[model samples]
Target chain A: MYNDIIIENFSDPQHVGDLESADIELEVGNSVCGDRIRVQILLDDNKISNALFRAWGCATSVATANIFCDSLLNQSLDSVCQRDVEYKQQMLGELSPSQHHCMDILNELHQLLSEQRVAEDVANG
Target chain B: MDRQQLAGYFDYNATTPVSPAVAEAMTATLGQFANASSNHAEAIRNRNAMQQARVSVAEMLGTSADKVFFTSGGSEANNWAIKGRLFNHLNKPGHIITTAIEHPSVLETVRYFEKQFGFKVSYLKPQSNGAISISDFMAALQEDTQLVSMMYANNETGVIQPISEVAKITSARGIKLHVDGVQLVGKRAIDVEACDIDYLSFSAHKFYGPKGVGGLYIKENNSLSPLIHGGGQELGLRSGTENLLAISGLAKAAEEAKCAIAQWDQHAQACKHLMVDLIQQADISVEFNGDTTYANALSNTLNMAIKGVRGEALAVLMDKKHGFIISIGSACSNNKQKTLSAVLLAMGLDEERIQSSIRVSFGQYTTTADIENFVTALNQCVKQLSAMSFAS
Candidate 1:
């Protein structure tokens, strides 16, 4: 069962689809459950200017992706990287044990974004 | 407004609201405080009520009263049948043949026997039409096979299996056959004598009766070891104190269903036709899951897949936004797992189809207006979810 907030977010996901000319794009999926999430981010002066996601999976994964992207907007990459699975779980209250993998998708996205940032810095240097 | 009051119920396969007749019967029997096993006068009255309930159930199944054994519910009855048959030959665990789409009661019980005990099981996968082939069943039969269990109708797809044909094969082979009739008992008439079913399991709640009450029909001369050991109730096959109140309700419900079978069938067929027609008119890219011909499926159930939109999300949107209630799959598997429906997958449906499929079922009380409203709401939900999923 999902909480009211999760349902609301899933039904009307705020930021969805790809952002063309974006700074970074990341795609991740769980083969076991077949949930896939693709996140595109735009950077402005080292801060996240925009973040959008496209998800094809269960309610939790889709809702969590939207909520994660919504939280990333206007925040610096350091703060986005600091936000862990627990933070997202708190945002969407009381996910069942079976649905906890939704947060795993967020973690995977963060790892991808961090790796992309490091690769960009090395290239620029 | 409360969602319970406004929502259109399309999940009859999960459970039914107790009919007023069944409620009144249960209320009247609730005051009977005596134990049914005692020899006192009050106990005699309680015993009489149990026997009457048994007779009503047997009548519905077209079997004799003595052949029926009451259990907690369909799950318990299924467990009793599978475990009891295996335990009958305690030292020798032979082979079991069943379908992959059976309810967890049968699937899990067989799994336990295979893992904990030494029973070998052959799970027959359904064809794309959602029916198991009789030839495949015949081929799976082995010399050491002792029992075969298959459902009369699937809970998710409502696809009816050819149990009568399998029955003839098992009977001729001298192997015991058990039918999980939980989904079929009230939707259609079952003549145990005609079908030659050795054991059958049924639950009352699926037919407007009270929950926690069901019965198992055992053919004459067949014996099963007791699953619950005590009190010697249910002819010692299932031992526990009788649930007099629920049994009375079950009997009343069974009687009502028997009397109204033809009318109910017609109403359900009409509702299904109307819903399908309305869905077609909306021009949604939809694929009806399972046997859409109604020749092999129940009249009341319709499973469909809307391209691109997620089934679970659509179910939530329909319930939360539109006051419509339907199911993404079997109620038993809804909240427990995140995987696509195993029933659809076993029918050779791809992942997208499985994820987008929703099951809708109706009952005697469902009206034409209810079907119209459900289709309208479904059309809107599909359009909205499709936009959100496919938008750039």
Candidate 2:
């Protein structure tokens, strides 16, 4: 009951691994069932230079991790931090009703990424 | 190309497809809409289906036809058996003994009485092998215990409990015993009279019969308060117009299952061994969960944990990309406000085993080729998942 994007990404995920010498590493895990995603990104001049992810959960959750990391490449911290509902809608990408629970995992990942601003602010300060 | 398009069906414990004979029986009664409750000739003809169902179910359980009472399905039967007897003690709340691994129908029903009606419930836990200890049951018994509710076999792990041993104790103490026999009815022959079961519930859909029709076996002399208040039907216990078509299907299915129990057991056991051999030959490390031996559990079910693989993801990949159908646990595994399985949890399994666990259950329709395809797909899926998994 998954969409084409999920099937493709889950089968051959491009950004599924750990990034070496990364500037930001954050994780989001479901408290109940332990579906988790960890994203590591490298920054150049406060802009994302490379992004990769490691995920453990359902296929959609893993695919969404890769999809989320893919969207952050070559992006600035402010732009990533200022993500809105549109970003979530784009990442969800037509999941079925049974697979829709991963939307909450996406939101949690997005929230954790946004909260990286606090760490960035401290570094800048 | 959507490669995963229902290639193999291994989740028989969830529900069985209607057998050809059952389907034909149901189809024959589709247009005959005479209510079994009526007193006319057509109605009497329709009532024969239910009568036939009662006889077959009685033969399966080794009881008389008069002891079987039809209901909508196992859930209603469970509700009636538990609440019907306990409802009689509305003025006086007593004790109940059940297992922590019971189906939700029994667990939640006991929990509701504990919460709303002030009944004291002792939820006995299962040991590591997924079977409840006989000593634990004995310890849980209280002087004022009015009833004991337990399942004949677990739906997820297929762990069979010591019902006969418990029945002997309960019989001597005069404590009512209600066994949820939904999963065990078709797989094993049950003699409710020999075991002295006070009440038992069963379902049709679990054994190639049409869904939405099941029954409860009440001992000949036992009395239970009516769960439904309507015209007298099911001997004034469960009051509703009989589902004639589903009843016919149930009777036919039960008849076939009764005759084929030994053959099905051997077939399912062979398939289970084939799967185990395939898993053993694979390069990956794995651990089989639960007590899977036929002496302790049903041979048709196998719960296992593949190292570092998430079961839900594995199930999704297997179902969506690999054309295999399995489950992380039972259909209601995440129910009862618990995301993980209460059965495994009650058995004291650690979180990792529970997280990585997937259940593959087969039945009369399964074959060795299906098992081979499933294992090959499972190996590929595990490789794909492990390569991408953060923890693995």
Candidate 3:
């Protein structure tokens, strides 16, 4: 349930707020739901050196976004973006339908990063 | 507040805590757990108890005991009454009339019938005051109009409908009238005889009973088909063994609601006064979305839009910091995070105001002190959120 997610992350989290200048960013949440978050990525070579986030939503949504960003850093961007569904699986402890949308920021990030790679390859060609 | 911790519970329109008196009565009935339809003496005792309960509920509605048919909840009653009748009359495709601001049970039922059963439903938009006009209802009625389903009082705004006039118009046309009286059953006085309604649905939870029990009042003169059929319980209109515990709770709850009608009104008024005082003290740009002076609305219910803040965000802030748990709309759909309420939109409220709306419904358990604390917390929260929105 969304309530459980809010309870788990209400007190402490590894990351919060935005990265000042980042190589990649992923935005999620719809205007209809009134919760929006952006996951920012800082790259070292092809690996994600740091990941931070800014979440504008309920406590559960904000907490989940911050937790997601904290778990993604230090991994290769490809693994976090394309090859990882484990990030959400790990942060949630178990999947709940109500809190499922909280993972959308990661989904959006992966799609955007994949697009960025495609754009880079086209530019090189 | 801890989820288990009790606070000043005011959201009665959403649901009420089962009253202690009702709970005891329900427990006592559990000893006779035999099925009501069997031929044995135990079954006969159970059947008698069920009939006695039916009479109690029917008396409250000013109808005969034979008219009452129990169901799981208001949604099933509404769905069964509407679709059941419409499908039974499938030989002639007919138009159905209803208000724009009905609950999801009614609105969604109409939509379902349209998609699957090939029926047409004409939804009449309520006035700015949240009451449907008789003139518009009469104009919408056609020769083939089979049913007109309107709620006695809206769950969102607590605005009562012009049901008497609507019933008269439909009755004169020989049209079946179905009312979703889930909100009006215990809060207000209802006389099905006077209204001439053929079908009505109400739930026990709205009046402080167990959640699963509800009833549908079908006039004996009206011929209707069963939505559920199997073991032939509920005279074959519905099936499966009866939920005796829940039904007993429902009967007891109805009895308490009847006896405490005076106290209910008094508490409702006090809660309304507290809400009015808070609104006046705040003095921010706000508006009550429904009619203030009309008799159609529940005195304890208030739906207001706090000028510049999103209703859901304020609701979240209240729950997080102040330990208050007000709602943006019906709790069932609150998770969907829809910005505008379909009911508010039907009332023709502007998009911005609709986005800022919240519903504060009072209950039997509320106190003046809770309202005072709520006002203080709300003023601070709204001021802070408004300032933050502007700064960003």
Best by DockQ: 2
DockQ for each model? 0.32, 0.42, 0.17
TM-score of chain A taken by itself, candidate 3? 0.74
Could you tell me how far off, in angstroms, the CA of residue A64 lies in candidate 3 after the best superposition?
Answer: 7.0
Q: Which number leads on TM-score?
A: 1
Listed per prediction, chain B TM-scores read 0.96, 0.95, 0.94
> What ordering of candidates by lDDT runs from best to worst?
1, 2, 3
In terms of lDDT, the poorest run of 10 residues in model 3 chain B is B329-338
Give a tens-digit lDDT track for model 2, residues B118-234: 999999999999888999999999989999999999998999999999999999999999999999999877789999999999999999998999889999535698888788787
Of candidates 3 and 1, the better by lDDT: 1
Residue runs of model 2 more than 4 Å from their true location after superposition = A1-7, A21-24, A30-32, A42-49, A74-79, A94-125, B1-7, B329-338
lDDT of 1 by residue, B1-392 (tens): 23355347889999988988999999998889899999999999999989999899989999889999988899999998988888876588889999999999999999999999888999999999899999899899999998999999999888999999999999998899999999999888789999999999999999999999998898953568878998778776677788898899999999998898778878888989998899999887889888966678999999998888778878988887777788994211223355668788899998778888999999888878888888888888887776555342
What is candidate 3's lDDT per residue for A2-84, written digit by digit as tens? 45555545324466555679877777765545666677788888877888766555445666666667666788756655555
In model 2 chain A, where is the ten-residue run with the lowest total lDDT? A95-104
Ranking by DockQ: 2, 1, 3
TM-score of chain A of each: 0.91, 0.89, 0.74
What is the CAPRI rating of model 1's predicted complex? acceptable
